[model samples]
Every structure is written in C-alpha cells, then in structure tokens.
Target chain A: MLSCKEVTHLLSEAQDRKLSLTESMQLKLHLMVCKGCTNFSAQMDFLRRACRGYLTRDTPRDDD
Target chain B: MTSDSPSSPRVTPETLAALRTDMLRFATLQLRDPHLAEDMVQDTMLTALNKADQFAGRASVKTWVFTILRNNIIDAIKLRARTVSASAYTAEGESLDAAFDTLFKDNAHWSPATRPVAWGDPEDALQDQQFWTVFEACMAHLPTNTARVFMMREVLELSSREICEDLSISMSNCHVILHRARNALRTCLQGNWFTASGCATC
Candidate 1:
C-alpha cells in the first residue's frame, strides 16, 4: 500500500505524467479509504480549474 | 468599428493599452520585479504595434498580445537562467522537502494537524473576487523560481519537457518544483480561503 505521503506525491505526478498500472492500483486503493487524501485530490483538481479561470479572466478588477 | 468580424479587434493603441494592466500583472507575477515587468510589457506592446498588420483573426487580440508577452517572459527567464549560477536554481529543493516533511510525518502519512479538509463547493469560491485576491496572495507566497515555473506550466500552458529544457533542469527536478508549487498553493489557499478564521473579510 502506498503511504499517504507517497499517495500525495503520486497524485501530483499524475497531473504531469501517466502512472504505472501498479501505481495506479495502489493509489486507487489508498484513496478509497483515505478521506484526507481524497480531499487533497479534489483540491488539486480545484487548483487546476482555478488556474484556468485565472487565464480566461484576463482583466481582473482593480480593487485588489 | 464597422467590421463584421468580432474575433480580431482593430489593433489600436487604445485596445492594446486597455490590456496593459492585466499584462503588467501577469508579467510582474512571473518576473517578480516591477521594473522588469514594465519593460517586458512595454516590449510586448511595441512588438504588437509593430506587427499590428499581421494580427490574424484566428485568436482574440488579448490572446495574440499575451502570446507575445509569454514569449518575452520565456526569453527573459532563459536569459536569467544563463546568468545565475546553477546552484541558485536548486536552492529551493531543500526547503521544499522540509515543507513536505512538516505536512507529513516520519512514517509518511499526513500529519494530523495538517491533514486535508473538505473545502465545500469550489464554484462559489471561484466566482468570488475575494477568492482571486487570496489566490494571488498565495501565489505571491511561493518561492520566486517555484512561482515562475508554476506560471510557465499552468498559466503559460507549457509542457514539462519544454519547461525542463528552457529552465535547464532535469525532468525530475522540474516535476519536483511543480509538485511543491501546487502543494504550497493549495496549502496556502486552504488556510486562507477555505478556513473560516483564515480570512476575516471572507
């Protein structure tokens, strides 16, 4: 089983590259039981979406 | 003003000037230096104006101008990489590991105090202007190189291979920096935006 730390690292790597089948299976198994890791995964997805949103909204309001 | 096509707005000084604030904000974030960002934006504007006639309607004028700015930022980053010592590029590696260590225990599990929590719906936060302000602040918190590389990958939409080559770092190194950057940004956001106590106004 991949440790939560390893799982998080793999989660980030999954964004950049494909994981091996074994790695994928391990990650899936870990995520099924790990609510924290699951939340972390969702946050990663949110971060990516936020970045895309940032790109499309070119003209940010001046109040910031 | 009478042109039927809306994709390509006429490249007038006003149109280009309107984009200056956003362009400067992007450049300033990547360069981490206001003066240099100003210069880069100036250069981008000049290049855009000089080649105004070549502005094809394939993409929005903002996109076209940004592409020019992106290229300029890339060149500037590459130039800086050449002049700075190779050691400087890797200075953040240790700190990144230390950051991860703080989040995870010796047994390689998340430290209970730092474990992730549900952030509720992200859409609401995305639509909030205060969320972007917090997001930019989190971005500003990153190490200079980490933020630059993150912007290159996420905002500029460059592939890892291209980033590795352009920054002259190994593929693994590039990945490590990117991972650290994401981790840092998320952690910051979780603290600042998601948690009730983190932001008084929000």
Candidate 2:
C-alpha cells in the first residue's frame, strides 16, 4: 500500500513507461485498491490521448 | 539494412508525413498553441529534410523527430520567457497554498466526496479544442521555470541531463522543478479542470 505521494510519483513514471517491473506491479496493486489513485491514473491516461490527438492534427500535407 | 554506398537513407514523403504528425503532436502538448505547434513542426520538417542524410538509424525515426521537436519547443519557450516581463520571484510567488485557496476558497460547492467526472466519454472535448484550453490554462498557472523544465522533460520527452544542459540548471534542481510542476498539474487538473462537472473544477 503506497502512500498518496508515492502513488502520485509512480503514476507519472508509469505514464512514461519508465517503471521497473516490480515498481510497476506495486503501483498497479495500489491502484486497484485506491479509487482516488485509480481515477488520477485514468485522468492522466485521458490527457495523453487528448495530447496525441491535438498533436496529430494540423500537420502539413506531403502531397502524397 | 546498411547500404553499400554509405549514403544516408532516403526520407520519402511518407516518412515526412509520419514525422510531421508526431512532431506536431508533441509540440502541441508543450506549446498549447496550435499555431506555435504548427510552426515548430514545420521547422522540424525543414530541418529533417535538410539533414536527411544524417539519419544514422541509431534511433527510430520517431525519436529523432521528437528530439527535434523538443529542441524547437525549448527554444520557443525560452524566447517567450525572455520577452515576458515577469521576474522569477514574482512568478514563483503564487504559493501552492495560495493557488489552492484561490480556487476553492470562494467555492462553497467543492466536495472531496464529489463524484469525479468520467473522463472516458467519447465526447470531442477530450480530443479537441477544449482539452487544449484546459491543458494550456493549467500550464499557464505553473511557475515559469518549473513549467519550462516539466514541458521539456515530460511533454518533450527529453532526458533530465539533456534538460539540465539546455536550461543550465543542476540535476537536483531539475528534479525538484519537475516534481513541483507535476504535483501542481496533478492537483490543478484533479481539483479544478478535470472534475466530474469538468468546468465545475478548473
């Protein structure tokens, strides 16, 4: 059971896919039990998707 | 596959389009200004085109484009920082406590027990302009240095050492700034911008 602070740190790293396997497991386990952390992770994931879409639009055409 | 001529790989139009799409997305995340992001992507494409023969295949095409995009964003933000009149002290003056108070102090409606807004809705808000607005506003609220470092590291996907060299900050300070920026964003997004009512929050 990670503290809120630890979970927060893990969430950021997890988003980057930078966590070690053990650390990833711990974060996942904590997320399963903690609704606040789960929601926070989900929000981060949502933001990444939003960013991906925003970044892909408005690209210059290659005339392909 | 190594070519016998030792010449660089050809950057086909398909490759440029893929790179542009990626660079644009990354720049948009960091700049929060589509125009600026577009310009950055354009600049990246121009540079990549000019240096097409420099493609060593040491990294993926995506990684190379992202590196260029990150560098461009840093340059843009640094230029903006120079033009802005805000001093470091004044920028950092908005204490975390004060920011929290400023948002929630007046709102008698805020509840810790409030049901969090479901972010998974297929509505275009999460995909289009509104998300950028919220993201941009949240970024604007960060302290200048903190925001710069965070954007370079997280959104731009630069390494900490790379950020340290670019920003001329120590590694420890870089980490500190990054930590502060992430925490601030996490709190801001959760409390204000991304709540159950969406607008009810940020």
Candidate 3:
C-alpha cells in the first residue's frame, strides 16, 4: 500500500493526465482506507471544478 | 449550438461593449495584470471588429471575442518569457514550511492532526461567489513564482514540458514544484471551505 505522501504525489500527477492502470490501482487501493488521502484527492477535484468555473458560468471556463 | 445561430451573432453595439468588459475581466484573471489585461481586451476588440466577417457565428460573440483575448494573453506571456535567476523568481521569501514537517513521522504516515476530514458537497462551495473569493485569496497566498508555475500548468493547461521550457526548469523540478503547489492549495481550501463545519467563508 502506498503511504500518504506517495499517494498524494500520484494524486497531483493524476490531475495532469491519466495514471497508468498499475498506478491507478495502487492509488485506489491506498485511498480505500486512507481518509486523509481521500479527502486530499477530493479537494483536488474541487479545485479543478472551481477553476474551470472561473470565467464561463454557463459552459466554457477559461480559468483553465 | 443554438445560442449563437448563423441567423444572429448578437454583435450589437451594447453587446460588443459588454463583451469588452467581460474580455477585460477574463484577461485580468489570466494575465493577473490590470493594465496588460486592458490592452489585451482592447486588442481583442480591434481584432474582432476588423475580422467581423470571420466570426461566422461558430461560437457566441463572447466566446469569439474571448478567444482573441486568450491568444493575446498567451502571446504576451511568450513575448515576456526569458531566463532569470531562479533566486529572483523563487525569492518571495517562502521556504519549505516547517509546519509540514510535523505532518509525517519518521515512517511517513500521517500524524493525527494531519488526518483530513471528509469534506461535504464541494458543489455547494463551487456555487458560492464568496467561496471563489476565498479561493483566490488562497491562491494568492502561494509565493509568487510558485503561483505562476501552478497557473501555467493548471490554469493555462500547459504541458509539463512546456512549463519546463517556459520556466527554464528541469522536468523533475517542475513536477516537484507542482506537487508543492497542489498540496498547498488543497490544504488551504480544506481549512477554509471544505470541512464539515468550515465557515465556507471568504
């Protein structure tokens, strides 16, 4: 199982692109019991959504 | 598709004027410079007016004008891109914070205080303008250079290689820097808005 730090690093990398199956599986497995890492990943998801909503309220978001 | 039909692109005087305002706001967010954003918006207006026929109603007037503005912003960044002392950029005086040291023991497990709580519906915060204000504040909290790299990657959606080339950093360094940035941002958001009892405050 990946440690919190290891999983968190992969979590950030996953934001840029899809993780490989092995990496995803490892992350998913780690996240299953690690509440802290889960919360951290969820926050990353929120950041992505919040940023995309930065400009385009209805559709396209230029906030990248 | 139906919003900006071929029948009408909605380029009225008032709409164009309003587009300018939106363009300026959008540019300001991307460029983070009011004066530069104004120039960008002005350039966007000029380009749109000149290429009025080219719009073709493929997108809404706002989208078309903002596209011009976005390109202008990118050009502005590229033009100003240059090698600098890493010391100068990272010189915002922020160092690896000591507080983070306590988050992990020798074994790299999360300390008790470091355990994050499950945040409630993030969508609720997304819909709140105050939440954005708080988020912007959190983003601004990062050291200036770190924030720039983060924006170029996440905001501009630049590839990792593009970031390394643009910032003259190594690939691994770019990855490390992004990890730091994401960590900082996620922590701040969790503290301020994501917790079950978080104030959701600005």
Let me know the TM-score candidate 2 reaches against the reference structure. Answer: 0.54
Which CAPRI level is candidate 2? incorrect
Top candidate by TM-score: 1
Candidate 1, residue A47: CA error in Å?
1.3
Report, for every candidate in turn, its global Cα lDDT versus the true structure.
Answer: 0.83, 0.61, 0.71
Instruction: Name the weakest run of 10 consecutive residues (lDDT summed) in model 3 chain B.
Output: B193-202
Candidate 3, B43-74: lDDT as tens digits: 77877887876777768887777777766776
- On residues B1-202, what C-alpha lDDT tens digit does candidate 2 reach at each position? 3354545435545677767655665576567688988987888888887876787777766667666776777788766644433345235735753543433223332235542345556345654555565666787777656676666665655777876666556665555565556656656666555552443322
Which ranges in model 2 have alpha carbons more than 4 Å from their true place? A20-22, A58-64, B1-70, B75-94, B97-111, B114-118, B168-176, B186-193, B196-202
TM-score ranking, best first: 1, 3, 2
| Candidate 2: residue B58 lDDT (0-100) | 76
Candidate 2 chain B TM?
0.55
Tell me the TM-score of chain B in each candidate: 0.86, 0.55, 0.79
Off by over 4 Å in 3: A17-22, A58-64, B1-7, B85-99, B196-202
Tens digit of lDDT per residue, candidate 1, span A7-62? 88899888878999999999999999998999999998888889878856645546
**lDDT per residue as tens, model 2, A1-64:** 6665566566766654468888988988877776666776776666556545543344343445
C-alpha lDDT (0 to 100) for residue A38 of candidate 3: 86
Could you give candidate 3's per-residue lDDT for residues A5-63 as a string of tens digits?
A: 78878988887767899999999899888888888888778777777676565433334
